[model samples]
Target: MLDLLKTPVLALQDFCVLCGRALRNIVRRPHYFDDIFLQMDIIGFGSLPIVILTGFFSGAVIGLQMTRALQTYGATGQIGPIVAVTLVRELGPVLSSLLIAGRNASGMASEIGSMKVTEQIDAMRALGTDPIQKLITPRVIATTVTLPMLTIIADFVGLVGGFIVAYYLLNLTAGQYWTPAYQILEWNDIAQGLLKPFVFALVISLVGCFYGIRTTGGTQGVGRATTQAVVVASVWIFILNLFITRIFVNV
Candidate 1:
């Protein structure tokens, strides 16, 4: 029983060794640049519209909620600062990471799982090609690079959404929203928020790829990998978020 438990730990350690060799191969063969660029487009550019829409609606709702909550306290003008802090510090990164994990990570697992089912991974190894260099590294780079960019864009759009609705719909002046918004959000708050997505990106890719590589059986295996990838990756993202928040708050 102890050995059965340790088997997973041993397997994970072996995976890291494989990852190091993969990274080396990736560095040596520059042709994988094509895959990297292609993934960035798929992961980054393709995700922009959805992230923006989610950000806009979330921001608008937050503004509306904050306005109502503050009105009860007769401190309605504080809505801007509260909205800004929430958007910049918490909502923006967390929401964006969860969305990306769901969107990209599950798809990644399914795609790779299908390849495994088809014996393409074995074929690549037989042909003297490093599958990780060809496949996993590009995903890792693209997701890590793209998510922070997405987070920043989401922050800006979300804040804009809040500001527009607050100033126009709620009858708060433009100055009322923008000024207090500025005052409440420190640079470090933004930085700490931004720092989180990289960890999430890594978690998503690792979990997705881990399941992808382990995929077996048949159609059922592919389906299982896809579902597990999203579920596990999202849970990991939430857990990581808690730790990150604690670190940021404490330090």
Candidate 2:
């Protein structure tokens, strides 16, 4: 039993250590503004189209499904509020983070893992360069900055999709849909919408870096790290979302 627990425990310890180091590097200089912006372009802009597409369809699907149930109670007009709240409070952040985890988390792991296996990281160490500062911190900062923005975009696009469905299928005027949707969102909901992605961004970047920096076994290890990074980041995103949502709901 102790043996069984050891690997996971050690991994958790390592992950926490890596996270601490990466975060600490943010305050310490050699701030790689160039690398940060480059990663932002890669992870942020690169992921944009999918985020928008996913947000739109998810909102449309929710709108379509809500129509029948809502009509039964003559609550069709409530669709806008329902969609808005769901997207803003839950789906938008979760889905956007998951998409990024699948996309950029894997990429981060693969890139860093390749560098690791190739001894490039070791060479950097020999040259007095901190790999965490150069490689991990930039990705962390970029993801933290971009994920919230992406989540916001996702939420807005999702609302638009819901509006389209409501306008056509439910015969809700733009005013009817937009007003309730706009009014129903509280500060708490907005906070949750923004906060979840920020937290998730940390998880995605850290997990990817952790798996990456620890990679061994050459090419096979790189593959393994990439897969683990995506899986772990995605799982943590959902887990954290639950806790975050619970906190907001109770607050």
Candidate 3:
């Protein structure tokens, strides 16, 4: 019982320490602008296609389902606002973050874990390079910047997908679909939508880097870290979303 309790506490402590170090590195001098840009391109561009598809399909499905449900009450017209709000304020960020956790977080952990197992990170330290500053910082910065942009794209694409379904399947006109959707959204809603992704970006990237830098053993360790990173990040996204949503609701 003691061992079980102690293990989680120690792991939490270690994670907090890693996060502190990464945060400190962000504002320090010698910022790796080139590396940051490289990571941005890799993360943003690499993840675009999947994000688009995920958003599109999610909105499409929501439209199909919600339209039918609303029709029961003869409120089918409200589908636009419902789908828009759901996609923009919730599903957009959540789904995109999940995808990024699976794709980028796993990749980061695997890559850094491989470096650790191969002793390349040690060589970097020996060569007077700070691995956190050089390797982890850039990825963190990139993810923080990229995720919100992706979420925006996802939200827009999702709305389009919703519009497509509403127009074709439900025979709703463009004005009937878009007007309520636009009117129902306020600055607060947009802020809430954008804010979650930024927080999620930090969570996913930092967690990935944390597992990665702590990798042990050999090739097997890399695989383990990669899997753990994705699972942990994905779970955190949902947990964080709930708290963030509550905050938004209360405010």
Candidate 4:
């Protein structure tokens, strides 16, 4: 048990060292904007549709479920606030983060792992280029910056999804649907959800790049790193969700 615990401690230390080095590289060698732009496009813009689909389903489902439950008390109007709070507090950030993880994390792992296996990373080092600074730093920075913006888009589309279900399917007017939504929707809730995605982005980029940089074997190892990146980033995202929620509620 003690030995197993120490393993995690060692991993955490390594992760910290890598993160610090990557951060410094980002600051020192700032000419790597092209890679950063590509990372942003892939991690943020590329994943928009999946996040939209997720938000739509999550919002529709919430309305459907809450309507069914609230029908017993004839308080169906509460659906608006329910959707609002869920979108701003939970569904928006969580689903957006997960979508980004699926795209950015997997890609990051594959790119770095393949580079490692192809000896391109070593080639960079031989050419007096810093791989961490050039590759990992740009990726990590781009993802962290893009994630929060993606969450904002998710929240908007999610609310629209809820509105579609509530008014169109349920035979209500826009005013009736939006009344309760605006009542409970707060800027702080939106802020809280957006904040978590940035942290989630940091976690995703770091874990994916770390596994990729450490990859061994060949194509199989790269594939394994890709899978591990998605899985680990997802698990950490959900865990972070609980912690962020706890802090939001406390504050």
Clash count for each candidate, listed in order shown: 0, 0, 0, 0
Task: Quickly count the clashes in candidate 4.
Answer: 0
Which candidate number maximizes TM-score?
Answer: 2
Worst 10 residues of 1 by lDDT: 22-31
Model 2 regions more than 4 Å off: none
Q: What order do candidates take by TM-score, descending?
A: 2, 3, 4, 1
Error of 3 at 138 (Å): 0.8
Off by over 4 Å in 4: 1-7
User: Candidate 3, overall lDDT?
Assistant: 0.94
lDDT, candidates in the order shown: 0.85, 0.95, 0.94, 0.87
Off by over 4 Å in 3: none
Which tens-of-lDDT digit does each residue in 1-251 have in candidate 1?
99888978986896687557555665676458889899999999999999999888888889888877788888878878887788778888889989999999988899989999999999988998777888888888899899999988888888888988788877889898889888888877988778998888878877787788889988999999999989998998888888888887965
Candidate 3 structure quality by residue, lDDT tens digits, 119-155: 9999999998899999999999999999999999999
Of the two candidates 3 and 4, the one with more favorable TM-score, higher being better, is: 3
Candidate 3: Cα lDDT at 167 = 95
Candidate 4 minimal-lDDT segment of 10 residues: 22-31
- Candidate 2 per-residue lDDT, tens place, 158-224, comes to 9999999999988999999999999999999999999999999999999998999999999999999
Error of 2 at 39 (Å): 0.5
TM-score of each: 0.92, 0.98, 0.97, 0.93
Better of 3 and 4 by lDDT: 3
How big is the positional error of residue 139 in model 2, measured in Å on the Cα after superposition? 0.4
